[model samples]
Target chain A: MSTPARLQPGDTIGILGGGQLGRMLAQSAAKMGLKTHIYCPDPGSPAFDVSNTFTVAPYEDADALDRFAAAVDVVTYEFENVPGPTASRLHAKVPVRPGVRALEISQDRLFEKQYLTKASVDIAGFAEINSQEDLDQALQKFNGKGVLKTRRFGYDGKGQLMIRSSADGNGAYAALGSVPAVLEQLIAFECEVSVIVARSLDGTCVSYDIARNHHENHILKTSTVPAGVTAETLNTARRMAEQIVTGLEYVGVMGVEMFLLQEDGEERLLVNEIAPRVHNSGHWTQDACLTSQFDQHIRAVAGWPLGSAQRHSDAVMENLIGFEADEWHAALSDPNACLHLYGKSETREGRKMGHVNHIKAKALTEGET
Target chain B: MSTPARLQPGDTIGILGGGQLGRMLAQSAAKMGLKTHIYCPDPGSPAFDVSNTFTVAPYEDADALDRFAAAVDVVTYEFENVPGPTASRLHAKVPVRPGVRALEISQDRLFEKQYLTKASVDIAGFAEINSQEDLDQALQKFNGKGVLKTRRFGYDGKGQLMIRSSADGNGAYAALGSVPAVLEQLIAFECEVSVIVARSLDGTCVSYDIARNHHENHILKTSTVPAGVTAETLNTARRMAEQIVTGLEYVGVMGVEMFLLQEDGEERLLVNEIAPRVHNSGHWTQDACLTSQFDQHIRAVAGWPLGSAQRHSDAVMENLIGFEADEWHAALSDPNACLHLYGKSETREGRKMGHVNHIKAKALTEGET
Candidate 1:
């Protein structure tokens, strides 16, 4: 079937993976008068609470996927780790935005690295590891220190181990459920930053201000915009993001995480990972920018024109993790804070319960100091 | 039963009426991680699409109301015209915010006028008209010129007649179905404006910047912020709004429409009407202010502290009446315009399909010019 020229107000967009991202995506779609049909396995998926229609069934269920595909005009997923076959199945019936290639490449660490290298994007050194021996040899190449990660379904520092020395590499492959993995040379980076970029159906691309991220215990703690990166660095990051999206022929938003390294008093950026969906680091845009990352994604996937990714204010978005959300009252009372809670019932340790974007007056320019 | 000290994140807010206002309110509630159960009789209610659960039954359906009340922690209505009995029934089961008194007072034109007068608020000269003779006498008091309106369930110029002269007063009462009505002397005002005020459960009141409104064919056309009213006039308008809400002991956002009459080289403010819910004039707040009127209303009704009613930018909000929304593509393409469309299937002339808020750089201060 040929794709429609553009989605109208009442067209339904099917979303896979009903989490906070999907919930926010649904809200963004609703803002534009579009309908959302959320498909997920968990009955208590948070996105289900705010969607037009939802189906509680496993992603691998062909019958359920077929019905969902038939019901929606187009499809997108919140998480990049959608099973390849499921996306392919849906794509056969309807347009799955960001396309199947984006999912395939980002789902595997090795493929992502390879794609980045092919696209001429700078990335850390890496090597495929099938067993302990392979991991040990790759670590030697990085001077007996590297980060070992499972090639698929890994997130928030999960399914990975840090090999500080040769002794730490022993049985590392077995520890990660013996899954196929990639070992990357660990760089002592000065700081971490991410760029959220959106590509529309006609190949139009726009990037939001870079967000310097802070992590605590492997989970994002806060992301501050006006990342303080030099103008040259910012330009390079944007160029890299545009290149990556263009190379993939992608549609929708992608979060490109990078390591800002300081070498000889000059800055260098190393492409770390790609998230083919709205990134947590971009949440500040919801309150500080003309268009939010979620809204940008919905617009791009809906075949609408891209909005200006301009920031009207500087902001720091802090995640309310676990019991941290209990302080929602304090967040609400702050005059400068915009509070967002994910409506999840249980808050286990490390689970994101909500977030607060503390807005401030915009500075004169990025890296003015 | 005593209301909870404050509503928790997971608590459900039961909303009455399933129009765009309720849809926006539910979106705001969801942003704060609160669940919403929309209660509207219309099967295709727009709000129903975004809520966790909804009941489709007449307002007077005691069984459905009881079930709805039992499921939600608090109840609020998007429209002031909710049947008094329905609100009181829900109040008996759970806290009905803005309280039953707000509903009873604002439901009738005569009562609203009397309440305004009792609050020492300046309103147009008005008289109750239950018969043609009563209308004739009221018209004579206004020098044969006044607006005759039904005392209940009137909106968007409906159930009202404009008496341009004594001849236009003929069949005025009968035209309104011979219902209880109020005839008010029509002031030839220089301009129209509205103040959106929010009063928390604790009686903390805050007001947004005054919005200068323009009408076309008796329908709202646009509302511009930084309304250019003299600061003294702005102060008085806010004071009048605060007085009205305090008099009613209100616990939600209210839109207080007023006429700005120029008399003797001085600006005189006269109260026009009270909308005891989120008002269309305040839609600009969604994109320009620290806290939107919808968010403010949700916070107030949920027994939370009120947010800052501060605008970071100047905005002009224009309603997309019916076919005007067909230019949504142009609106979306404009970098400064934030478009919002209500998910209505069919559009007829004069029906409100959506709105667009065009934001500009912040001016130095309100009424600075």
Candidate 2:
């Protein structure tokens, strides 16, 4: 829970990253009569196209940061990669929603694991892989198989490597630029799910229906709503998300990724990662709920009450990767689809250009379809 | 029916007249990955806040019009006030949707009435009022009550006068500077409703669910959806909307105002006026349907098939008029409400600064006591 600072409708909401998520956030902010000023380093960022006000300088540029801080009423970011120093700088000047402490835990895998451990949250077996000897020791303990991820600055299957045996552990450690890393025992999880929760500065929190995601080639392919799970598993997922966010005193929307693991007849949830801002998996909120996660993020950061996170219908969100956005018109003509384009000019493989959401009532005879 | 041309994603859709409607239309265009270039006389027009490009010059500025037309694929205006010469200037270069002919008729009330009449559409009885003698003659045939409106331009109850008596007519005519006017015998009506119809170049027509309007101080106060009309009336509204569009060979979206008259024991509809572009009455489409009227207009003008005009939910949209915008914060706090601001700097009395749309399930049982 954080201070309950109220914001008026015309308040300027400051966004720190300038990707599709931030672009959507700015759009949502404008829709609610709130102005948005985007602060990002990329001079050609897509979000800048829609937002009239922006600072085109690096996050660490003090002059630009100061100007951005002075212009906006509240500050929030689209990604956890926001360096802790930059967050601290802005927090000193403006009400930085989600706060600097949340960034500290999310920016580093080690810090995230440490926070989860102190909260008695479940996680895969792991250890810090610093020295070559440390990798060997962890590899032997985990049946000679484990994943080594950079302690900080890793995303989208980058800055991480899987080592099946100690034979490649030495090579895998170097593949990570020989940086300080966290080693984790790989879990054969049955499925991956995410809970997107919005916690306002007033301590009010609302969680959307969990979504089961399927990734292809290390990129999110599709996400289905009403993720089939027992009531106990659903409640556990919600409680785990609440505990992590409340413990971090986070504000705005936060996504907690988890592994749905099953062993014989036993089933439980395991913490995978945490996003301090809105997650791609929650894109379904734009069509399936009364309020979208991006809109909820703006509302929460603006000191407005958290909106209904309840799902209105079963939904599926498919990411338009690379040139897949070329089929936008066809998707738009589909009676069951709502297409969204990010207005990005450049197209390259694996770049998330846009997404589409389909909301429909879940079939009554649903199994594992 | 004009030839339907395929407009791929990222095509430019040029819009003339940069008022609030154009501002909203530009935003909807950006959401679809389409570029919008707003051409308007006022440099401070609100639509410039969201459009990618803009040209600020008078409508008669041929140099500006040529550049505007050359820079975009198709041209449409936000208001019918677009002069005939300006439409011709653009039409000579770019293919203007809902072309100059429609613009000329819409800008002048006399031409609009004549066209509708030629199409066998029913309308309130009216006579031309030019001189004092003509006013006296019109008053004689008025059956003791009438409304006189300027034939060139009138909106939101402006440029129109109520002729309660011949004595009042002199004062009204004098106030109007005795401009060319049309006199209409006042008719008793049940409710005021508007039909927003979209017609593609190929004559693919689609009309949104009718919007029942409530006026306060002669300005639109609220628009309610589902209009709560009999099936027969609804079908007629759609058919009439289509007929008017097809008659003019109009492309893009046009708003047709119709009077719902319950004369004797039967209900009838009368042609009132037409807006040759995206309209305020259709603002509810943003929240109440899968496809917004503004987006539908861009689609049609871009030569794309019209999206479904399905009403996703019954809605009530209320304008935050004048100083009523002072309650913006309260409106933003409502979970059931969606607020949209025009980004206008001033909020004088009777000026439309913003609007709020509330979409809820239709009150299934009428007269619930």
Interface RMSD, all candidates in order, equals: 8.5, 9.9
Question: Which lDDT tens digits does candidate 1 get at residues B1-369?
Answer: 557748999999999999999999999999999999999999988898888889999999999999999999999999998998999899888999988998998999999999999999999999999999999988878899999999999888888988898789898789889999999888999999999999999999999889999999889999988787787888899999999999988999999999999999999999999999999999999988878999999999999999878677778999999899898999988867888999988888998899999987432211121
lDDT of 2 by residue, A1-369 (tens): 223277776678889989988888988887776788999888878787677688889888988888888888889999888977888888888889888988988889998999998877788888998877888888889989988999988888888888877777877777788899999998999999889988887787778778899999888889888787776787788888888888888888998899999878777889899899999999988876667898899888888887666555567899999999987877766655777788888989999988988756321110111
Candidate 2: the clashing residue pairs are none
- Please write out the lDDT profile of model 2 over residues B89-161, one tens digit for every residue: 7777778887788888988888888898887777889888787778778888876578889998788888988
Per-model DockQ against the true two-chain complex: 0.36, 0.23
- List ranges where model 1 is wrong by over 4 Å: A131-133, A170-178, A361-369, B174-176, B361-369
Top model number, TM-score: 1
In candidate 1, the residue pairs with backbone N, CA or C atoms under 3 Å apart (3 or more residues apart, or in different chains) clash, namely none
